[model samples]
Target: MATNRSEKTVSVLKIAAFAALTPMLLAGCTSIKDRRGYVMDQALTTAITPGLDNRQSVEGTLGQPSFASQFGDPVYYYVSSTTEQRVFGQPEIEGHEVLKVAFDAAGNVSSVTTAGMDDVRDINPDGDKTPTLGRDRGFLEDLFGNIGAVGAGGMGGGVGGGTNGS
Candidate 1:
């Protein structure tokens, strides 16, 4: 009788522990969603009309842009991205958008264009070293190569051109 009761109690405790931990286990598997940059609003974006809407009006409609072109024709870029990340994984871009509002010399909106995920490009860098047009140097060469070159041309040996005595 004592054995039967202890076994039943142990089984009930096991079931209760599993029930409490089940939700947490499932929650850990869910991907975390994150939104970055300017949040897009359909109505506000639609309100912007080229030629009619100027910089001020567009700013009032869509608020400030994510960035603006510094050179060439003036353009305002409203960029947004939605990413999902697992518990210990890098965030993957699920959605991306870039709204480009170009302006003429008059500062009025000349053209409005929206680019979606199709314009998104994935760039994988080549290892840790940056590729350059120079020669490939080894660890020893990099350390000792500069030894003879620095003071050879009377370049960096002295701090100033003046004599040591004032």
Candidate 2:
């Protein structure tokens, strides 16, 4: 009887210990993310050759680019990234790529370039002031600019702007 009771207590302790640790183990598990643009297949991307693949062919093969340049040269960008976010923490970038395809003025494929995250650059604006051509107004000018612009509401001919037919 003593041996049986000891074994039962040990089993109960083991179960309780597992139950207490189960949540902690699950909490350590993290979520992976395939974000932004779709993942580019190596073979498919390699098949795209500049000067040979035009807009139509490129679209037909690799699909539309993640973004297109708004300025000159008409460049298309294929951006892809994989991120991992931990519990209650900002996501960390695991992989990133920027594929640029330039189109000639004639609308043909001009060149293809591939760059990693190291190529990214942050732009810093030149000055604190935005530089406007208009004249600057003082605080008093702004505060009193609209003074006397409006008259007393009682001077209006119609009280409610409604006319009753006689």
Candidate 3:
């Protein structure tokens, strides 16, 4: 009887342990298809050829773009990302791809090209310089700053105290 009870306890413990770990294990196994559609929409692949598509005919089809630039000449960009996650392991980037399409003055595809991670460059690689609007104020200038003392008697406590007796 004692042995049987011990075995049952062990079985229950195993079940509980598996139940606790199942979610985390499943989380790591999520496939890219689950996130691909949403990511693609957020990246805005369609807007890449906005003005270029004419009313009469289609000049060319440049599949998708990674994202559209907030500033600069109108350009559409497309990007693909792959990530791997494992139990007790940090998610790591497995792969990435980007494509860019630029339109010409007449609103037709001007150029199409691919850009890898290495090709991208930070506009302000170093850092922004702090602006020097003017010279720093001295200690005295800060202490005797803008505020002036209360006028002679504007309030009850001032020199022009109202008729109310103290």
Clashes per model (N, Cα, C within 3 A): 0, 0, 6
The alpha-carbon lDDT assigned to residue 112 of candidate 2 equals: 83
Candidate 1: global Cα-lDDT?
0.92
TM-score of 2: 0.66
lDDT of 3 by residue, 1-166 (tens): 9999999999999999999999988887765422231133323344444455631222234343446667766566666666766655676656555666666656565665665557645465657766668877778987886556544345345643457663
* Most TM-score-accurate candidate: 1
Instruction: For each candidate, give its TM-score against the true structure.
Output: 0.79, 0.66, 0.39
Per-residue error for 149 in candidate 3, Å, reads 8.5
Give the number of the best model, judged by lDDT: 1
Q: Which residue runs of candidate 3 sit more than 4 Å off their true CA positions?
A: 1-11, 18-98, 122-129, 137-144, 149-166
lDDT of 2 by residue, 79-140 (tens): 99878887778888877898888999877888888888787676788878676677787799
Across 1-166, the per-residue lDDT of candidate 1 in tens digits comes to 9999999999999999999999999999999999999999988888899889999999988989999999998999999999999989999999999999999999999999999999877888778867688899889998888876766756756656657653
Worst 10 residues of 1 by lDDT: 157-166
Better of 1 and 2 by TM-score: 1
The regions of model 1 sitting more than 4 angstroms off are 131-136, 141-166
lDDT for predicted candidate 2 compared with the true structure? 0.83
